[model samples]
Target: MAIGDSVKPAAFQYHAPQSVEEAVQLLGMFASDDGRIIAGGQSLIPTMALRMARPSHLIDINGVGELEKLSVSDSVLSIGACIRHAAFHRPVVGNPLGGLLSFVVKHIAHYPIRMRGTFCGSLAHADPSSEWALTAVTLGATMIAESLRGRRELHADEFFVSIMATNLAEDELLVETRFSLLTPGTRFGFYEFSRRAGDYAVAMALVTFELVGGLIADVRVGVGGAEDRPRRLPEAEKVLTGHPPSARLFEDAAAAAAAAVDPMEDQQADAAYRRDLVAVVTRRALERAAA
Candidate 1:
């Protein structure tokens, strides 16, 4: 037990599954009690210690090294369930995903937390304010999940249903998430506001754009921490795509983004304040991408 953490988790059986097949079988067997999968344990352990989560069996998949797969195939990136955030922070030359990953990983938490945290763990956790989750939504990433029954793929929009919620089945393990590489001319910008460094963002904006003949050929805007789920701001994107970039247009798009999501009041910030932050970040992100 760590010092100052006196609260103990409820006693539970543990299973270290060595293969995806074995993991799914155990997951299916424990569906009655709702088995919990632990990947870095950054979120799971805390929830368990708080007595907020008590699973009959804890399935630790770290032993299944196949889940640690990380490779670039055909210029697209496929990140496995067990790949640590620290691996994504490494310097890689001429890789767009690596560049974006490094930027996002730096904002996740402290170095030790990054060292231990898995990218897929955060994706499965489905935290609305997670930088990775926000980026996944912006990238329109694909999720691969496997169960004893079979395997299925999910798009980012289809996977995240709400805050702390996902389409992942109880008996399925998230195997990998695939991300498309941005084209050569793509311009991107990511920004967020938190009370302090390493703290969860109160409001965040991620933008990507491609210019053709001095007009926006493609554009995407994703807002996080202000609503129940990460989402692309279609209204905002509509304002930019096929139009020439302008400060006035960006201002309008920012307003559209603030209107796109219904943020709720919380101790961290009120609905009105979050909406204002959303506008500010969205405008800045769009401007940055245009620049």
Candidate 2:
């Protein structure tokens, strides 16, 4: 039977490919057309159990050695899709991005779950509440995708579309991600509000700013869980671009961010509340970055 015909989270064939080429071939053969990539399985497994996602095949890349690399070359950091969130929870020793990643991963979930969650999987899943997505938008990360045809790279802005969605094509496999190194003197801050410590965030904000002399040389503000996808607040950033940091200025900028967003009401939060939370967290994140 064709894979797409199987619904109800029914039994699925599993394939463990030892290399990217093999994985790409398997994806082209069955998984990509109607199969799912099983990397961390932190999100996909639960969805499958609930029958929300009923892919007919599971393509496992756990044994793909090259897909597990973490390295920095020529100022670009490339992280394999299969790396566990736990490995990123602490400073990566030599990589500065490690510090920022560490800050975000801590709020992903508790210890055990983090040990099984993949950074690229979160990127691929494109959860609006995902800290990875927020960071990707804030930092303008790039994603690398491979297929039997060829390879393609997409910027963060191009990759994410909406909640629980991404631009990744069905026959393509996310291999790794590349992040341009932040300039020296850049400061970053993040804040999120969730019902509980590990619950998905209701509203999240993150910022990166660099001060020169007495003025803000550059600043970027982004919010998630307040819209369909992670949103970069260029209007708010504009307010702080060359201005000196102050409480009133930050308030105005944060207000702009809140006003610019269109949030949705769900069981966890109302649209109004999430909007307010976005303002609060945006302000807090800016303040933290400025300090």
Candidate 3:
């Protein structure tokens, strides 16, 4: 076969479901047939083009009107599966979470990719360098999955397993994801390092905390791309809690984060380099949050 023919995706049947129940039913039917769901098609399309993923059936959920819902209620922001990353370009609500999302969303790929990529799709993709995945883990977001079996909720800690993998079952669809709003007085800071402007982050950090009586409280420090999965660094958070926001304290927290992670290494970066980046990004994010 020619190289061009080898790169092309295999023939597959397409199914467009207009409702959540219908989608779940189709998924159940095709679960054993290597069926896959397609949303923004940002990540999957590229893989498909290279013949890395050739599902026998492709389930399209964009036509489902109910899945496009985006709302803030009961102190939580609910993002549907069809909600694009571009949706967060503006503050979706009057809360700090919206602003934080707006700030981070700009770091995802390029303008065209943002217009077509969905927020939940990023989480479902589960790339270690994904900005949205780091944000979701930092905020302790909840993932809602639906299938013919039933509906279930998975916390951020439980949702992500490893690089490009999640707890999502073969027949389950990620219907929605919800994030608890950052309360008043909560400050957020985020920083990432990459080779180029639109490239995936080699290491990134997100920090959120509230100041009580001039001391840090409710601190959350999340590190991504440096490890197999993005996660909260309790060691770093512990270093920050009850401390005043000072350069010394931030550096201490950054050091704690650097020590805590078993950094991932690839052709572009070594383990030592990734760990150093974790320290740098963590400190920068803490500085921004404290600003």
Which prediction has the highest TM-score against the true structure? 3
CA lDDT, every prediction? 0.88, 0.87, 0.95
My TM-score estimates for the predictions, one after another, are 0.95, 0.95, 0.98
In the range 1-291, model 1's lDDT, one tens digit per residue, is 774467788888999999989988988888668788888988788888898998888999999988988887787788899998888787433655667677778888778888988999999999889889999999999999999889999999998998899999888889999988888788887888899889888999999888899998778899999998898989999988888899999999999999887996789999999999999999988887777
For all candidates, what are the clash counts? 0, 1, 0
Q: Which model, 1 or 3, shows the larger lDDT?
A: 3
- Could you tell me the C-alpha RMSD of candidate 1 in Å? 2.2
In candidate 2, how many Å is residue 223 off? 0.7
Root-mean-square deviation of every model: 2.2, 3.4, 1.5
Error of 2 at 107 (Å): 0.9
lDDT at residue 86 of model 3 (Cα atoms)? 94
Model 1 shows how many backbone clashes?
Answer: 0
Candidate 3 weakest lDDT stretch, 10 residues = 1-10
Question: After TM-score superposition, what is the CA distance of residue 86 in candidate 3 from its true location, in Å?
Answer: 0.2
lDDT of 2 by residue, 1-291 (tens): 886576545688999999999999999999545788899998988888778887889999888999889888898888898888898877763544667788888989788989988889999998889988999998999999999989999999989998888998888999998998888778888888998879998998999888899888768899988898997999888888888889999999999999999998899889899889999999998887777
